[model samples]
Target: MIGLAPIFSYDDQLKRFLLEDVGSGDVTTRSVFSYEARHRKASAKIIAESDGVFCGGPFGSRILSYSDPMAKFEAIPDGQPYAKGECLVAMEGALESLLLCERVILNLLKHLSGISSLTASYVEMVRLLRKSSRSLRITGTRKT
Candidate 1:
């Protein structure tokens, strides 16, 4: 879909994010997994830390794939409501690869969820207020 095309197109941005967080390879993960670790498979689930809207499923998938092409990922559909501790992403791949991409994927999920959650709250608040006055609406101001 067009939604996913943008993610793949922004190679520099994704690489920058990884480079900023993980530089010259992840020493910690590398130390734990040896060169032969690519054959090892590991599975992990991303759990929500707080209640919010799930808004980064696709982003998470893309980030993981970018970090490790062999990493298998499954993320919940975006723009849906989720409760705290809900599983947002399920990934199974090489242990080292999973560890390397974990932080970036989680960070993206957290950021997107925060924005969607706030927007959802504001919409709910407006809905409640709108019930009292159907004529009241949120509108953009334009100057002629």
Candidate 2:
């Protein structure tokens, strides 16, 4: 099984992305949430709007951890199949922290999941077609 080790290997890249998205600080979250409110506990979940092969669960957990070390993040394993309306990730943390990382997390999840889902569909097609040709195979390239 693919584990968190592979996800941790991308820490540097993920940090760069978080830094780019959260340059200086999150002005909106800071302004909208008073000091007390910022620390108020909140819980949220990312629900799938469509069926797809879920990806980035570990990365999502890592992103949330960066925002608030005490935050709790739980998600289905990456590469798991999900259905529309299913919860992909569930997290609880300070309101400010959650809001700060929400966009970055959502964007990553959507982008990665889309690619995984599409690739799964292509592989399924190949599997169906391969019955007629024993030598046929489907492989991925690093070009993307």
Candidate 3:
């Protein structure tokens, strides 16, 4: 079925993210680029600075939408593995909007992908051990 990326209900929280990150204004951006920057179209790839499994696609999409309604971001879907320097997220939109959301989106992707990669490693280890011990089972306990 075809469906648009549903605008998550956590828009307020997302707005807070923008506010916290931007504050009064993007001083560096303002000082660095001309007012013409806002009118320019731009594109970027969120490359994997290190090898990992990708995660946080939905959240990254939300951040893009929250930053600019017309902006678009794409990743190879969550839980997919990507090699170092591979494009994890691709975005295109107004130059200003793209730059504005860049760091936050990358930070979320990196953090979530890091966890996913770590979990994959653990799964691989457990599977290897389980081959020799059929009764072995992975168990997890959580505070929540």
Candidate 4:
């Protein structure tokens, strides 16, 4: 079977890679923009493109919080059903902070959500198959 790319030597390295990708600072966002004078909340809507058992809602929420401590996070609990185009989580926060954190948030969402989707697909396929009958019954009848 084909293997996933960049197979880490250590299991914990995946989170390190993600943090490294984000870097110590987002230089562009920091240099180019100024914080707005008045406080305002920004809502980030996480919409699922396809049906999947939603598995990473909390991680996605934590991504936002990690990006900006002041962010207000609300998410449908993890391991719940999420239909296509449904909102999984929402964050209300400062516009500049939200923009700075959007990519990281999406990355987490994409990765864990994909895992959930693939697992669900495998489960559904197994559920539809007559595995015991196909293997055991076929073997017994053939022997007779």
How good is model 4 by TM-score?
Answer: 0.68
- Report, for all candidates in order, the number of backbone clashes: 0, 0, 0, 0
> Per-residue lDDT tens digits of candidate 2, residues 1-144?
465455445888777788999987789888888999999999999999999999998898898899899999999988899999999999999998898888889999999999999999988888888888856677767897
- Candidate 2 segments whose C-alpha is farther than 4 A from its true place: 1-9, 132-135
- Residue by residue across 1-144, what tens digits does model 1's lDDT show? 555656455667767787788887788877766778844888999888888898877767777787678888888888889889888889998787788888988887888889989988988888998998865555556767
Between candidates 3 and 4, the TM-score winner: 3
Error of 3 at 15 (Å): 3.3
Clashes of 3: 0
Candidate 4 has which clashing residue pairs, if any? none
Candidate 2: the clashing residue pairs are none
Candidate 2 worst ten-residue window by lDDT = 1-10
lDDT of 4 by residue, 28-95 (tens): 76667665522357677778787877766666555566656788877777667788898877788876
TM-score comparison, 2 vs 3, better candidate: 2
Best lDDT among the predictions, by candidate number: 2
Model 3 agreement with the true structure over 70-123: per-residue lDDT tens digits: 887778988888898888888888887887888878777788888989999988
